[model samples]
Target chain A: MITEGRAWKFGDNIDTDVIIPARYLVTTDTKELGKHCMEGVDAGFSKKVRPGDMIVTGENFGCGSSREHAPMAIKGAGIACVVAESFARIFFRNALNMGLAIFEVPGISGGIQDGDRVSVKHDTGEIIDHTNGRRFFAAPLPPFMQEIIKAGGLMPHVLRKIRG
Target chain B: MGQTITEKILAAHAGRDVVVPGEIINVRIDIALANDITAPIAIELLEAANIPSVFDREKIVLVPDHYVPNKDSRSAEQVQIMRRFARKHDIRYFFELGEMGIEHALLPEQGLVLPGDVVIGADSHTCTYGALGAFATGVGSTDIAAAMITGETWFKVPESIKFTYKGKPQKWVTGKDLILYTIGDIGVAGARYKAMEFDGEAIEALPMADRMTMANMAIEAGAKSGIIAPDQVTVDYVSRRAKRAFELYVSDSDAAYVDSKSYDVSEIEPQVAFPYLPENTRPVSGAGTVPIDQVVIGSCTNGRIDDLRLAARVLKGQTIDRNVRLIVIPATPTVYRQAMAEGLLETFLAAGGIVSPPTCGPCLGGFMGVLGPGERAVATTNRNFVGRMGHPTSEVYLTNPAVAAASAVLGRIGSPEEL
Candidate 1:
């Protein structure tokens, strides 16, 4: 699967509380969560983000708090994918479980800047910076994890297994 | 290859002879925990998957301590849904409001977790049980749903980082300070996807409470889990409360580690994490007089009996600043009862502080003393990310119980020595 989008860059250690504050966790509605995505760190994030936009960040993205809401909000806000130097363990799993594509490419942040046109190939683990004509590679997801992403997250993945 | 303690625990749970980092393996879960906030969504996912019943009701534990006492109609509905599900499924470990406590703190105290077990919870602090020598980690609700249906989950055996502490901690410097200093030394992402295996003479000398405090914040440094090898101290603590016999495991002497570091605690001072990230730490002596609107001394991190005793000792015969509101919350009802029995609660009350029952309270900004806009707080809870305690403009400084109590008295960031 290939995804193309504009990049939105952030610094290192963007915690879950910055992605979605704990106060907005009262509801499980994806839209409600998306509405407040990145409110803590960037007040205009939700309003400015467009569908198919990608998030690029430095290391330890989604570092604090184990709330799955962080990734849910990122996915809900119509982000096509997230490319980070690294991710907190729980956030990495949560993003994939919620059907959001994420990639870890060393120095990926240095290659992309805010609003740069970028394309990602999930199958090949390649990230292309269209604006700067730069190419980078990310570690490909393992087969089983790719299967879950293809099924639109863990719930559906489990459901498919149950049916089979 | 010889295995680290984490690999050993996972190998045992997976029924394998050996395991290695980056290898995916399925393992049976000894315990699956969820609190009110995460359980409702997990229940929905479970129903969506068309799973009629849980794999083992007895292994599932639900605690509704996040917004307990029904903070609002929506929260009340959420808790009610979990309550109904627990009752219908006959999950033996469900704890209602009166018996409810923060899942991380209450689980071990209730003997729901044992040594060498593979545990997962919907909350991040679930890693706290690693102090008991368990391979416990946090997962999302959908993962919990999958675990509920199958009684097992998959894990990529993680690389391990070894932390060795030497000498002794100074007075009023506790595990909270040590862990804070460690996180500061290693950036927030230092141990991503790795086990933080804590060892050393100083670690062995730490009390169970301090161990829990350290383990509780492992997630803050992006660790999969923070673990300590089971020793006589751990044995004494777990055997007295564990309902069943448990196996103890330790790392092999030749176990490989991705990285290792050593610290001398006698040279370390009390530490505090500044706002926005836990890694932004500075010693209390140099933290300057950053005035605070509130001081919270509780949470799964440093909310035990010893934590209360430390705070009470600092607050004895001293009243907190009138401008600052100090909120003390016990992590569990058992801890609360013990504090009350020992007059800790009375001392807090006398010091112009509000003592609350066992609840997560303002730790996650759920309720109970939410800060106003631009307000700053010094708290004993883990995590001080942007807007963690209240409004988006609010800030929180993370510190130990001694610093929190002393800061409350001085109306600024202070230490126990100032008291």
Candidate 2:
């Protein structure tokens, strides 16, 4: 899988409350949550997003809450991909569990800027900053996780496993 | 090589005699939990997967404490989904409003979670059970759905870090202060993806309530779990409430650790975390004279009976300051009844404070005491993140119950020493 989009840069410790506040957690609908994505961090952030846009952030991104709504909100806000310096453990599992594309590349946040065109390759774990002509490699996904993504997320993988 | 307590518990659950850090392994789950906020999503995903039956109805625990008692029509509907699912499956540990508390506190209080158990909840504070020597952590809704169907999940073994506290604590320093100071030392992501094993004489002497408070905030330091090896205190706490036999897993003396830190508790003051981050801490004595609009003393973090007792001790006869709104929530029905019997409820009421029933209402800013724009509060609940208790412009100062109670009476961010 590959995705190319403009980047929205964020600082470290961009927690879940900033992703989608608790008040909006009343629903699980992706689109409903999408409208409020990053509402706390940068108000009207979702409105500025174009389809297939991506987010580039610093360390400990999505640092609080196990609410998958954080990832769901990002995905719903038309973020086709996310690349961060690091991720909180639960958020890393959550974004992938939902089939969202997220990569971790050390120092990528510093090189990238808002609206920088970026592209990512899932199989090769390659991340390219097209505007700056710089490249980085994310830590490769384990085979089982790669399989989960190939199946379009954990739910599909589990569905196939139980149904098969 | 000797194994850490986390390694031993994971190995037992994985059906192995030994396991090493960073190795991915599949393990059986002893308790699979979800609350109203996250359960609705898992329930929806379970329907999408077309799985007709759960792996074990008995092992699945559901609590609707996050936004229960029907916060609104939407939250009401969300909880109904979990309620109906619980009834359809006859899940044994389903807790409704009256019986429910904060899921983390409720599970341990009811003895549903035991030492050496593998517990997973679709809530970040699931790590709270590690206080009882369990290997527990938080997961996402989809993961909870998978566990619901498979009765199992996988984990990458995490490296262990050891923290030891020496000497005795000063007056007004409780588990909240200790954990706050630890977070201050380590920074938010200091223990990311690692197990924090809390030990030493101070820890052994700490009560179960304080122990839970310490473990509950491990997530604040980006740890996968926080644990204390079970001792006589644990045995006594569990034997009274736990109906099933439990296993106690302790770290071998020679266990490996990625890092270790020792602190002299006598030198540590009652710490308070400033707004925006739990890592931003300061000693209470120097916490500038900032007036507060609200003082909340309850949540999964410090809403236990002991916390209420301490707050009541500080607030026995003093009325809450006219400028402050004091909202106290008991964690569970049992705690509420106990407080009533002990007149803690009367004390709070007489002090001009309103006591809420067992609900996680204000902690996550869900309801009950949400801060208005530009308002500030001193809360005993965990996480003073921007907008954690209400408006994004609002600020929350995180402290222990005694400080919270005193601050309520003083109408500012002061400690019990002031009273």
Candidate 3:
């Protein structure tokens, strides 16, 4: 699978609170969550983000809270994927479980500027910086996770198992 | 190759002889826990998946702690889903308002989580159970949804880091301070994706509440779990409450570790983590007297009975500073009742502090005591991140219950010795 999009960069320690604050946690609806996405960090994130636009960020992309609302907000805002130097483990699991594309590319943040074009190949862990014409590698995804994401996240994966 | 306690627990659950770090394993969990905030989404996922029923109703536990007492209609609706789902599923452990406490505190108090158990929750601080020597960690709601059906989930076994705490703690120091000092030594992400195994003279000497406090903030250090090998203290604490049989897995002396550190507990003072991150810590004596608007002494991290008693000892016979509005919240109804029975609530009330019901309350800035713009608070709760306790411009200073109580008396971030 290939994801191509412009990059919206964030800095380090971008916590779940800023991605979507607790005050908004009363509702878990993705679209409603998207409408206020990153309002704590960037007041205009929801309005500015476009479908297929990737969020490229520095280390610890989703630190703090286990609220899946953070990633749901990003996916709901129509972002194609998130590429980071690293990710907080829970957020990494949450994104994949929800079928959101995420790439852990070491030093990927240094290569892509905000709004630069980027492409990611999920099959091979290859990331092509279309804007800068540079290519980088991401840590390979485990095959089991690949299966879950292929089935549109863990829900369908479980359904397949339970119904089997 | 010898395996750490975490590895051993995972290996036993996965039916493997031994497991190494960074390998993936799917283990059958003993306890699958969730709260109102995460469980609603999980229930929705299970309903969406059309999985007729859960794998083992007895293994699944639900608690409505966040926004519980249902702050508003929307929050009430979210909890209503858990209430209905539990009824339909015949879930054995559904803790409503009176029976509820913060999930982390409640589970331990009731002996629902025990040593050698593989526990997962949809909430981040699920790692708190690690203090009981359980292989526990936080997961996303979808994981909970799937685990509800299969009683299993996957993990990329984390490398282990051992921290050795030596020397006796200072008079005012507690588990919160030790964890804070450790977080300061290791930056927020320093131990990311690893198990923090704590031990040594000081840790072994601490009480179950303190051990739970240290393990609770393992998440703040970005650790997968914070654990202490169970001993007599752990055994004595659980024996009274735990009705189920349990195992106590200890780390092999030869177990390999990725990193290790030794701290002299006596050298560490009651610490305070300044605003924006729990890693930015300083000794309370050197905290420079930053005036505060409120003092909150509660939350899963420090809302246990021990924490309340420490705070009450400081607040007794002392009037609250006119400038500070102190809010004391016991983590669970049990702690609340214990504190009430012991007259700790009276001490707080006499000191001009208000006692709230056992809800997370303003710990997440969710009500009870939300800060106004530019207001600053001294809190015993974990995480002093931006807007954590209220308005964006408002600030939070994290410390133990003692320092929190003393700060309320001094009307600033100060030490108990100052009183």
Candidate 4:
């Protein structure tokens, strides 16, 4: 699973309230949530973000609230993946459960600027900044987590397990 | 190797003699909880998976406290979904509006959780049960669905951070102040993916309500859980309300920790978190006269009977500023009844405050007391993220009940000493 995209950068502590505010939480429809994604922080985010764009952020991205809407919205918006310096624990798990690929690369945000073309090799955990010809490595996901993501999130993974 | 309290609890649940940090393991769950907001989504996922039945209906607890009284057709529909799922699964602990409180506060009071149990909830503040010496944490709706199907979930044993407090608290300084100070000291992500073990003489001496307040906000620091060893105080608190036997586990004296910090409580002052970030804290004396339009005192953080008594003591005879609107909500119906019986509700009403039912209404901007553009509020609820209460332009200051009451009277940030 390799992903190639341009980067959209944000700062630290980008909370769930800013990702998709509680006002839009009336429904669990991922597409509707994607329409309002990042509107709290950047009003034009939904309109401007293109499919296959990657989000890069400073430390502690996705903090506050255990709502899966934040990651679900990001995934539904056609964003390929999120690379952060760190993540709030629940957000990290939620992203995995929703099959939204996320990677933790310390100092990764400092090296890449917004709109920089980048490619990620999920299997090898290699991040390549095409704009600058620089490469960074993130720890590979564990075998079981990789399988869960491949199965398209937890529900599918569990269903497959039960069927087997 | 000596095991930390968190390791001990997780190992016990995993049916292992020992476990270490950073190792992924599957553990049996004792209690699984979901509120109105998360339960609907979990139920949807469960139906999508085509699972015939829940692993154990008796172990699941559902509560609809987020947008209770049917704020809108959508929220009402959400609650209906949870109700249908509860009935379909024969869930034993389904709580309706009248019987419900905030899940965090209600679970321990009803004795559904016990010491050394592994608890999980779809809401982030589920870590609040760690106050009872349980290995509790929060997960997402899909994870909750998986747990509903299998009665077990996976976890990575987290590294532990030890916080030791000494001496005694000063007047008007409470658990709220201590937690604010700790979050300020360690930035919002300081304890990411780690277990926070709170110890020291001052912490143990704190009452159960205050300890609950401290443990409730551990998620604010990005901690997986916050815990205190069960002592005589825990035993006394649990024996009165608990229905069944429970196991108690303590950390070995030689247990290892990733990091440690200590503070003297006597030297600490009342604290507050500024707008948009729980980590942006300042001593109350230096908080200045930041005017406020509203003051809220409720939520799982500090919405107990004792928290109400503290606010009532500050607002006994004085009225709030005409420009200010004070909203005081008890966490549960039982807490509401106790406050009314103790005259706390009457005191709030007499002081120009509005007392509402036991709902999480204003805390998460669901309804009841949402702020308008450019309005500012001082609240006792956890999390002060931008637009948490209402408009993106509106601001919230996080503090304790006493400070919220005093600020309501002054129409600005102030302390009980000013009264």
| lDDT of candidate 4 over A1-164, digit per residue (tens) | 78888899999999998988888777899988888888778877877777678999989999888898899888777788999998888999999998788999999978999999999987777999999999999877888888888898888888888788
Q: Judging by TM-score, tell me the better candidate of 2 and 3.
A: 2
Question: What are the fnat scores of the candidates, in the order listed?
Answer: 0.79, 0.78, 0.74, 0.79
Q: Which candidate is the best by DockQ?
A: 2
* Top TM-score prediction, candidate number: 2
Question: What is the C-alpha lDDT profile of model 2 across B1-419, one tens digit per residue?
Answer: 89999999999999999999999999999999999999999999988767789999878999999887778999999999998989888889899889999888899999999999999999999999999999999999999999999999989999999999999999999989999999999999999999999999999989999999999999999999999999999999898898787899999999999999999999999988999999999999989989999999999999999999999999999999999999999999999999999999999999999999888888998998999999999998889888889999999999999999999999999988787
Q: Write the per-residue lDDT of candidate 3 for residues A36-117, one digit (tens) a residue.
A: 8887778888888766788899998898989999899998888888889999999999999998888998898788898888
TM-score of 4: 0.98
Which of candidates 2 and 4 reaches a greater DockQ? 2
Q: On residues B1-419, what C-alpha lDDT tens digit does candidate 4 reach at each position?
A: 79998999999889999998999999999999998888888999888767799999889999998999779999999999999999988999999988899888899888898899899999999989888888899998988999999899999999999999999999989989999999999989989999999999999998888888998999999999999899988888898888777999999999999999999999888898998899999989999989999999999999998899999999999999999999999998899999999999999999999998888888888899999999999999998898999999999999999999999999899998987
Choose 1 or 3, whichever is better by DockQ. Answer: 3
Clashing pairs in 2: none
Error of 4 at B121 (Å): 0.5
In candidate 2, stretches whose alpha carbon ends up further than 4 angstroms from where it belongs are none
Model 3 spans with C-alpha error above 4 angstroms: none
- Superposed on all Cα atoms, the candidates' RMSDs to the truth, in angstroms, are 1.3, 0.9, 1.1, 1.1
Error of 1 at B336 (Å): 1.4
| Best-matching candidate per lDDT | 2
Candidate 4 wrong stretches, greater than 4 Å: none
> Which residue pairs in candidate 4 collide?
none
- How do all the candidates rank in terms of DockQ, highest first? 2, 4, 3, 1
